[model samples]
Target: MAEVAISDAQERSAESPALAGLAAAEAPRAPAFIVTIYGDVVEPRGGMLWMGTLIDCCARHGLNESLVRTAVSRLVGAGRLEGVRIGRRSYYRLSEAARSEFREAARLLFAPPPVPEDWLLCLSEGLRDIDLPLPWARLAANIALAPNRDDLMPVDGILMRAKQLDGHGDLAVLAADRWSLPEVAGAYGDFLASHGGLRDLLARNVTLSPEVALALRLRLVHDYRHAALSDPRLPRAAYPQDWPAEEARNLFVCAYVGLSKAAEAHVGAEFLSPEGHLAPHNGETERRLFQLRREAAG
Candidate 1:
């Protein structure tokens, strides 16, 4: 079975120090990694997966069956996943409550919204725990700022449109003050360093087996998701001169595209919904690959 081959591939990967080291360097928490697997692989093909299939996929990342079960229990408790039983087998799918969150995460991972050029300055005396459209940061107790976007419906608040004057102070300093830019940069840097070897190895025309390719692709998305989601994704003008986002994004595209063919082979063979095994290509999957390929080419 493909799952057995992944175990074999892990043993063989020891012969390649780069692959071995990369594998051992990171073991993402079981719950988050499960979410990544679902978002990237399960959601597009069909928003469901068999428990046995999920456990097999998680095993590639060194998660034990017990750990995955515990993680799934927690996700169900958190309303992120819901389970169904068919005969004696268990199947799970994204909960309706969590679909929006998963969709947002997918957008960030695949097709992130561009930062608007204009700005919105919101003032509210009673701003407590409110969900304004994302990428907004609280400047003060009663003031918040976000890029002015028209697509999102307006929230209940006093909104003002503002523009940067011709002569402006450094926006990067302001951005740094408002958000955790240093931490985000460090995450991106670590991702680049940790995965650059694999990227280079692929560049040399080295081929990977389907199992190995799937593992690497999963790891790639798992690591990049942390950095990308943490980012507020402000306008380019506000970014620090040395921002590594673009560089990280470029690497993500290259690595994802490079690993996708073989990885999809593994997915088609292994990833299953209650209906059946996932298709290798679908509208959602095709859209993702098409966009990433264009970006890689560009």
Candidate 2:
């Protein structure tokens, strides 16, 4: 039998005013159930859970019925939690990819960069100006490991053709198809993790509408993907010398600083540390990302 030991500290934190406010009214236990479910199935061969089974599991953990249902629904909607329907009952399980994504997200949320603030900024600035001769061939390898999207490619072609008609040029079809959305998302996730503190700073100080924030994040992510793809170096290639690797590094840092400010302005300062650590946002971001993922799955 597997067991999860919820420490007294966890109990107290769950009951804390900060956490309580984040969790919706009438669902104090939802957050706890979310953590429990994630922890339970994070490992391999942990066994699948059905709706009924989850209900039972919640009971064991003293979670309320309503809260469990809400959490499960939200998780399912987010993509972190998946469901298989047979006849009447729906079986729930975490997708393998989701597990890896969540782990990466958690690491980003918790891990702190060791570089000094000034040095980090200097390196980032230097990378931007010097373009390294990246090995573009590595893009093939990245494409192979990433998810495929034939539907998007057709749309891409249509857009390209339309641009040609309008006398505007676009990349060749092959090049356009070289990158996958999941890989892009994954890369952005990695980028966010690496410079989370900086992002926290931005999220806190920036005053932007929700729509603008989303646009900024998407644009930055897109720029990163294209930059990686255009490099002659392989998809996994490190920053090349052709560009100022330091400048590029600084760009990433600045981006995170902006994202941090946005998160703080929209979410709350409690989710970040004075130095822009994401410890406070770890649980919330995990839950939000999980929910977003569940929605994607459906």
Candidate 3:
């Protein structure tokens, strides 16, 4: 990825001590609007959206038109949104790479070994105290705490049961249909920002044992597959039966590579196995997770 260039004004704003403190406090308060926009655009068959239409839609959610427009522009600048001009209006869509990144992000958020529900309960309480709208908070909490199934196939059954219990089956189906990568990413980012301990844990555990890492990776894959498959919009035709397995394997490899590279920055290559792998050590949480996954998979 190329480094982003910021203007002097932006640099100043970023450096201001007061603004920095405010940003730290506010970031968690805002859920992933950028990712949500991306998901809204991509979940549909067209995958392209008019900027004006998006602004109007966000307006219904109490977001200022200018704020929504600015957020879209920032996402475009970040390469997550590709701009296409038709006549006088501009349309934005996700690039292929952005889609892949969002897919990985979605997998991470809905994956197994879920985050604790109390984390979101605390966030919702904080938002309530500040008089913030509760829809986003409610939705985030639902996604995070949804029951995990053994595999992807059984997920649809759960969704169907949820519909039967509620009269708004169609609404539930519509909402599930709209779930997408960017939305998941935005929610995950928001959740992480709200929970300080989560951020600290991710930063500190850079050299997780391979066994533990694999377990975490598998859980994430399992949950992602289940979530996506349950959604009405994501049909089996879009993702074949074998796709989940393949994607899961690919994610594991990518995570392993990324973690190993990060570890190499501190521990010398000598600590790595002869085949450039990280072995499990006793007392590592990741190793325990790996064992749990083994039982789950079996």
Candidate 4:
């Protein structure tokens, strides 16, 4: 599952200037990488990861050790992570306060979407943006639609599910109308162009260092996440004649599948126990990755 420790959005993680300069040049903030460390790697490990394990994992993704160290300390201080010293080594886990949110985030990040029972048509004129229980698209200065039901006359705005609406059209049209297609498609296109190159490079059997493979994997997933997660799961009729989401998704799966083997090898090597045993594949990552491959293939 992918997530950041969230306070406001019930998402995201720590904030500090220690990682500012490097963040500007490299990947996301150290805190963000820490979030990745949790969602992509650590959360699967019973919410605990060895300190050295984290240092090594983040390094593969291009984070500096010192920055990671700082972020870890900041997280511990901020009550996001609990550190315990076992023998001569230290391990970190999600704090009691954070575990529930992390688990909820995992459900969204990892689990397949349930069959659509209903869609919420949220109208907010003064509020501009509304926060629904569903994932994605909390920021737009207009009405929004979601594929969930909330049966209460909320104080903020009207949460209208399919039953409440008098009119009807293709459900895809609702999704298409609620969001800006041009903006969404443009993002999808840009990611596909880059990810398509990654697929080609991987197909060519180009050699990549562990660090380079990790970086490519993370960037590919992160950008794809930004575009795809925000999508309203609209039907093809909702998009222009040729929507790019399917192509983008395939590129993501292909690139990720290509990068995963090497990346996992690097992780296993890096996350050794004090007894020198390699970290075991917990199977969750593999399960999700294989499912995605199947989705791409299908």
Candidate 5:
């Protein structure tokens, strides 16, 4: 059994008034917060959850039950979720399409894919008509460039592996031209400014209440998700020396793991799935905590 050993320091930190306000920083929009709850908690235990559980969780973030219901209705209409009526209770699960999308988001958060070492040079006559994904930038009428990721392959062009050899231009300059480094950097900087203190608080071995822990964890991931998804995951050589993406990632891992124990306790005791209260320590939850701990150690 995986166990969270709380220190006496954490017990004391819980009594501090300043530390208690960490989770009360600010509330995100209802739709986004609901998505965060499903992605972080519901998706792991099972893809489905009770409506009451969702409302109760969102309430911690100052989202009213009516707003949550409306947001959930909108999510269902948008094909992000599906609902079923079980007697008087209603349960919602991620739609198949949304599940696939959430899985990709989860990869970027929990287990980031490696940056592509090779570059792809795609040459095609019909480049304008073709839709190229994965941050491909059109360099010419018949050519485009992108980091060759394993998950993406463009069949519309003659793809060739490329290596830069003694080029006059700096890689960082090329990166800025091809991608919005300033925007991405700004997002990371914002994330650090907002949640950076949580890292220090956790380092002091602070133990938050289950409600606060879960609320803060949701907020943490909700904010980090915006930044992580925006990032194109370019090779380290392509990034500026002052890039704070890695630092933000490390802080996320530390604070997330620090809060996992109390957060899971909240889920176990309060959050409900179609099958009654969620088990606090399922394989998926344990695996996530274990993987994050390993990431924190590294």
Candidate 6:
């Protein structure tokens, strides 16, 4: 058995207030859509936007304006957003607590994947009942492995280098026990199938209407972000054979880059600034993300 150790710091972080209401409120479809919108547009672009601009952005995705308004109201009630009104104009910003949550998300999504130091196979009592931030996989009773140690949780458990074991007997089975490789791979596969053909068509120099461009862009980001959150986002070694992650990523890049100009045109024309003018609301955050994507493609 490997030596067991506990991390006090990790325990405190698990109960951190920044992550409140994430999984709970996101169960409903409208809230989920609103969260996606926040990730794609609101969070990155100076973190504040008018209510009308938000409604118009959702409208491109075929969401009703009233429905979008309701979603925003619920999000504010849920403590994820702050709503402000000046005269007749209304605006919302990511609550400071919510900003911390999404900042970590943005870091994970954009940074290059890193290899972990070691895989800790831990056996501890009351693990299921205890709240730790480990990317947990339950082995028999009172057993789990920390696949992600990037942010180690405060827990007492045996530790060992991943290379020390040949993954014999139970270890071989435990990897599967920890994460459902097939399901994660299958999600990537489904994502690729849904968007692949359109990506290829765009690659062949097809044109899209401004509405279509913005709508498709939102849909693609919405789905991709959801997948990223659900996935363990392990290293390439953790993937099963025939994993479609790279393929899905390619389709995402192709479609988003191909649609950028038209989508920007639409937002620039349709979404106005706080000044109530038809000025383009381009910001550095948007440019940086697009630049990162373009660099990744090349």
TM-score of each prediction: 0.89, 0.28, 0.29, 0.66, 0.90, 0.76
Which one wins by lDDT: 3 or 6? Answer: 6
Candidate 6 per-residue lDDT over residues 101-120, each given as its tens digit: 77766655555346564566
Better of 3 and 6 by TM-score: 6
RMSD of 3: 21.3
lDDT tens digits by residue: candidate 2, 1-298: 1233455454454334322222322322564345434432222223244566456434433466787888878877777677777767676666666677545433332231222211000112223334322111122211211112121111111111111232444323333344333444455444444334434435455344432333244334333433333322212122222333234445553563344334333323221212232232455445544543443343
Candidates 3 and 4 compared: the better one by lDDT is: 4
Which residues of candidate 4, in runs, are more than 4 Å off?
1-25, 60-62, 96-111, 114-118, 121-145, 148-190, 207-211, 234-238, 273-280
Q: All candidates' lDDT scores?
A: 0.82, 0.39, 0.39, 0.61, 0.83, 0.62
Question: What is candidate 5's lDDT per residue for 249-271, written digit by digit as tens?
Answer: 99899889888888889989998
RMSD of each: 3.9, 18.3, 21.3, 11.2, 4.5, 15.5
TM-score of 4: 0.66
Rank by lDDT (best first)? 5, 1, 6, 4, 3, 2
In every candidate, how many clashes are there? 0, 62, 1, 2, 0, 5
Instruction: Summarize candidate 3's per-residue lDDT along 1-298 as a digit string, tens digits.
Output: 1333445455454334322333354321012454554432232223566666555544433456778777777777777778877777777777777777655544443233332222111222333233222112124322311222222222111132111233533533333333443454444343333322322334444444332333233333333343333332222232223333334333433443334333323222122222232222223323433544553364
Worst 10 residues of 4 by lDDT: 10-19
Q: TM-score for model 2?
A: 0.28
**Pairs of residues clashing in candidate 5:** none
For model 4, how many clashes?
A: 2
Top-TM-score candidate index: 5
Task: Tell me which residue pairs clash in candidate 6.
Answer: 4-157, 6-155, 7-154, 7-155, 10-154
lDDT of 2 at 38: 47
Judging by TM-score, tell me the better candidate of 5 and 6: 5
lDDT of 1 by residue, 140-165 (tens): 77788886765444556799998887
